[model samples]
Target: MMRFDNIIIGMALSLILCGVTIGAERFPPPDFVETDHVIPSPTVPGPRQDIYEYIDAVVLLAALGLSSYLVLRRRSRRAIFVLMVFSLLYFGFWRKGCVCSVGAVQNIVLSIFDRDYTVPITVAVFFLLPLVFALFFGRVFCAAVCPLGAIQDLVLLRPISVPNWLESGLRLFAYVYLAAAVLFAATGSAFVICRYDPFVAFFRLSGNLNILIIGACLLVISVFIGRPYCRFICPYGVLLRQLSRLSKWRVTITPDECIQCRLCEDSCPFGAIKKPTTDWPTTEYSRSKKRLAILILLLPVLMFLCGWASSGLKTVTSRMHATVRLAERIYLEDTGKVEGTTDASLAFRATGKEQKELYADASNIRAEFKLGGWFFGGFVGLVIGLKLIAVSVWRKRTDYEAGRAGCLACGRCFQYCPKEHERLKKIKEARAKY
Candidate 1:
């Protein structure tokens, strides 16, 4: 069976690699001469790029299906790891990290808020496929298909477990990131996620120097920490975590059942396993009850305080938008508080537009941020408050179980489970008799 599985993995890898090889040869970079005309933003794919996008979408769908089967049914970490490599090569490097599902999130949000925005069919498919798969098959996308996660997973050499409390606290940043990404995209401020994507420099092979440094740092951290970006920072993973909780199928450490053998306890580098729990002492329960109640009462107050605080950052936050930045630049120039005009200011002047119109547009953008800030900060507070409440509650468990929301479904724990080995042994014996 092991030989059979290896043969299967090898064949699949060959097929994927063959496709990648053909694609690389077929789509050499365009030889356009550089002129003064500004290069168009890739919001919409061109004729050749459109063909690549469709191909990418098809590959994404196939990879997700294969990933789900490998994680949930095969329970083969080796197979999953093989698929992960192909995904990293095809989606991350070969594709140059454009038209990715992660960045497509902003396109979806922009379309939702702006009537004029139209999401490309391929981009829309890229965004929705993994989420739909996640609803049915847990985070198999994270397990073996997401190039970002695959890169981190491959570099994980000496795994260090982050403390669970610290991990939960750190995860709040993802919620904040998601909210901020939505706010910026919705208001045409920016796609901050794509702009600041820490791993993209490595994927595209060239990018902002600071961004490349950041990506390098993250890769270095991944060597010891095991997918820090996926666990603590991925805004898309934040969505996947929630949807995975309601998945119809999920990865389990043991094929049959958990036997509390303790071997698998330390297997997961991500620290996603939850040990069995005993009832809390009555005294502990009483204090916990009081704490829970206090947290519940504080939730509303936290939301209000956070919203007000965020609203106060409207001026700073709104500056992220081009119109707002231009307004400020114009104001500085008019007041003689700074140097000569920039190319942008000169361009605006060239348009013969009145200063008031720019200010009014900036003001409207600021207002949008003001409202968005409230929602963003209020969401942060709400998440924080819920985290506190969740910690205060205790649940009884008799068997070691994977955390539904936290598990990446990487199948790393399977090898440590004696029950899993037993199941495999039985399958081998049955096959031998046949």
Candidate 2:
């Protein structure tokens, strides 16, 4: 087993070097001077081959299916880890992390908002398969299939537990990120999620120096803290967390019944194992009810304030649009606030477009941002309000169970359960008798 593991590591390292060479050859920067006046293409460096795209879709389907089987039916952590390594190599190093399910979300949202945009079938498939699986089998995708998650799981050498309160607080960023990604995509402004993806740089073995540094930092943090990105930074994880709550079949720490051994108490690095609850004091319960009522009454007020405040920032948000940026740059230049012309500004001047017309277009885009900001901020406020209420409320459980929304179904706790060891022993004895 050690030899086999060494072979996999060696192969992945070799591919990393090869991917770097290929990345350098394929993604040379543009020669034109950088400027904000020109529209940026949404395209990223992905595979151009139609055959490869189809192959990727097929492989993704197979991996998700196998992951479900391994986690649910076989209940084998070794198998899951092997498959996770394969997925990291195939999707991360070889495929360069493009056309991923995480980024496919922008394509889906853009298709809904823009009439002219037609999402490719492969992209749609990549986006939906994990969601469908999460609805039925919990987060099998996050267990072993996602290249991003797999890479992080690999770097977790000395895992530490995050306080549940801190975990809940940090997860608010993912909600905000999802809202911003959707708002930007709906307005055709940007794919902010894809643009700032930290791990993609590691996968492709080359990227912006700033992004590479960020990716390295994340990996270093992951060694001590388990999957900070998945828990707090992944936008797609927000969707999966909701869906997994409604899943039909989910990961259980014990194969049979819970014996309350407490052996698996510290098994989960993500703090996903819930301890059996004790009854709360009557006074505590009464206080919680009062707090809940107050928060329920306070929810709409928070929403309104957040919405009103966010709408006021339309000017800043709208600057993400090329026309708005060009208008700002032209105004600065016209007022003698800045020096020379950029390639984009020179190109726009050659087109004989009036500055007033550009400003009008920018103004219209800001008007759109005004409404989007409302929804974005209101959604954030709603999430916060609901989170407060949930934290105040307490649920009762008699047995230690896995958190439906928080568990990655990684099978780490399986080895810690004595019941599991007993089950394996019985099976071995039965096989010997047969």
Candidate 3:
């Protein structure tokens, strides 16, 4: 049987393909491309802003914000809970991607390609809101705001923990990607953060085929591994993790609990719980010693380089690579050496003027790289740095505090709370005895 998603995706693809065909036949490419700012397209009734776009972004943020507030406030608003789920599906996925952070990433990339591009508000919101939240609420942003993380959180059924070494290693990739993207963005090359984002196609409900494939892979991974993207790959998550470390309030395994039954540890689906070690004294002492040793060894070097290296790589490499690739492809095709060559190749026949234009266009590559790299790197650094400073002062922390930056505000806990489940069972048994 086809999964509901398969059916939805199939229908969506069919409708989109049909619409494209009709649009092609009627409108032509030039007609499809908006040339003039003719009244900025009138919006229909509903939420303010573009209806679909606004709803998708608003629903997730609202659900995340409200749900976290309620839970944190120790208030149960059941109606809001229902609304959160409905909105997540309705506004988040079904509405199609509009201003979703995942899609906003693409806008950042486009801004790199076109000099006339202006910074988009959505992109700015996606990048900054978490920082603001992290400062006060301690990763409540992860708890419910992120659409991509929320979807994966909901689908997680059985999650086996990967070894910590492997998990940490995988996590390093996000940092590397963050650094590279920042370097690219800072150099004004492109928004690599947006360009290779795995979730944008899902959010947009339309994008490159490869992106769609990547989104699908993320979904499949979520079912078994529990938000692999957030845990291991999301550059945004790296920023969140850093903020959470110093967050004033972290979700802890309360020390005053009546018993150390370890139920909470078992209930945790995301492997966030860590039982106190059998050799707590030795482990604590050894761990501290190792950390001190490492810090003592590296602190001076980092202090010297952190400020300068963080800002400058002067020479652009990623964009240069992209330029060479594009040039090579163009050169190959122009020489009639392109496989399956046909009349289709006629448009790209290089005039001297066009070649000159293309060479000068290399600036687009470097600009995009700079934008992506700089934005990601500095964003991560500032957020993480803020958290590190906080940790130094607060000295209070918890593992359950939503895995640094990974609280995709899905209402999965509403369904999967083992405590709630056990309570329900006990009530049933008591009723039977009565």
Candidate 4:
């Protein structure tokens, strides 16, 4: 049965790829007539573009559904791989990677804080659908539907296992990035997440030289790192990891009881599989409890110190907002402290807006950043305190299990279980008898 399924999937993928190639050849690139000393205007999308966005949302939903079925029900890694390829083609190259869930985090934040900013329906769907799926089905989206993860997964050739301590520390960057992206978006500053996306250039086939270089570096690192962006940089992944911990369903190492064979121990490249652990001794347990208590007592102090330090860096954080920078430049240009006026300062002067009013606006934005910094720092401290508490605590596990928060549900471990092979043999025998 598995062989038959593989043949069918292979044929289907071949046909799809061939069809896409023919279609591309049939529709040649349009010719552009360039005029001398003329700058082209940006093209605006029409009603049809809006309809296409809705279509993309529906396609995303369908892809998510099929991915869930493939991972949880069929348990076919080949099917998941084929699906990932299709997603990479359709969502990545074909769509040019617009309306991505990773960047949609900023759009959702801006929509909430800025009343005038409206989020398109497709952006909202792109933002919420994976999270809703994670609530019930774990990170199936990550397994095959997310184009970014799919792209990295394809290039992952020789994945080296990162040390547990180093991996834990690196994962902190994702949380800090999430906090910073939200703060900037809420304060009407720049969307740092979109601006710094390393893979967008690959999707669009054109971008700044620096970003393209970063993308190239990430792909090269992915040859050994195994989805570095998903594991250490994606802000949306942070939310998915938390939601997956509470998911109703999850991927199992085996369909039946464990035989303690340990075959699946080294199967996962991402180091998400957890081994069985014995109970700690009474003395060691007592020491851990004491440490936990001390850490809990110190949590408030950590928060206060972190917040104070963050507030002290307000001048730097406030610079993320354009108005603050503009106000500073205007002040310098007006007071004769600077040499000449910048284009921004010239524009401000031309607007006839009062410098005092601009200063007041910049001050309000700075105040917002000050409060945001406190929350951001407190959030980091809370995460650290929780991590410390988690370390001191222990959970009982008698069998090999996937880490609830760490597993990407990629289905690679399924092939490593001896019981899975036995089950497939049994199915083959049954089919032969029929």
TM-score of each: 0.88, 0.88, 0.60, 0.88
Give the Cα lDDT of each candidate: 0.90, 0.91, 0.55, 0.89
Ranking by lDDT: 2, 1, 4, 3
lDDT of 4 by residue, 332-379 (tens): 887899998889988888788999999999999999999999988888
Off by over 4 Å in 4: 1-48
lDDT per residue for candidate 1 within 87-106, as digits (tens), equals 99998999877778788899
Count of backbone collisions within predicted model 2: 0
Off by over 4 Å in 2: 1-47
Off by over 4 Å in 3: 1-61, 75-84, 102-117, 187-195, 199-207, 252-259, 277-434
Ranking by TM-score: 1, 4, 2, 3
Off by over 4 Å in 1: 1-49
Q: What lDDT tens digits, residue by residue, belong to model 2 across residues 1-434?
A: 37898887886787686776533554456566776566578978874879878999999999999999999888889999999999999999998998799999899999998999999889999999999999999999999999999999999999999998999999999999999999999999999989899999998888889988988899999999898889899999999999999999999888899999899999999999999998876879888889999999999998988888888999999988888888888888889999998787887887899998988988989999999999998999999999999989889898888899999988888888888888889889999999
In order, what is each prediction's RMSD in angstroms?
Answer: 16.3, 14.8, 13.1, 16.6
RMSD of 4: 16.6
Error of 3 at 237 (Å): 1.4
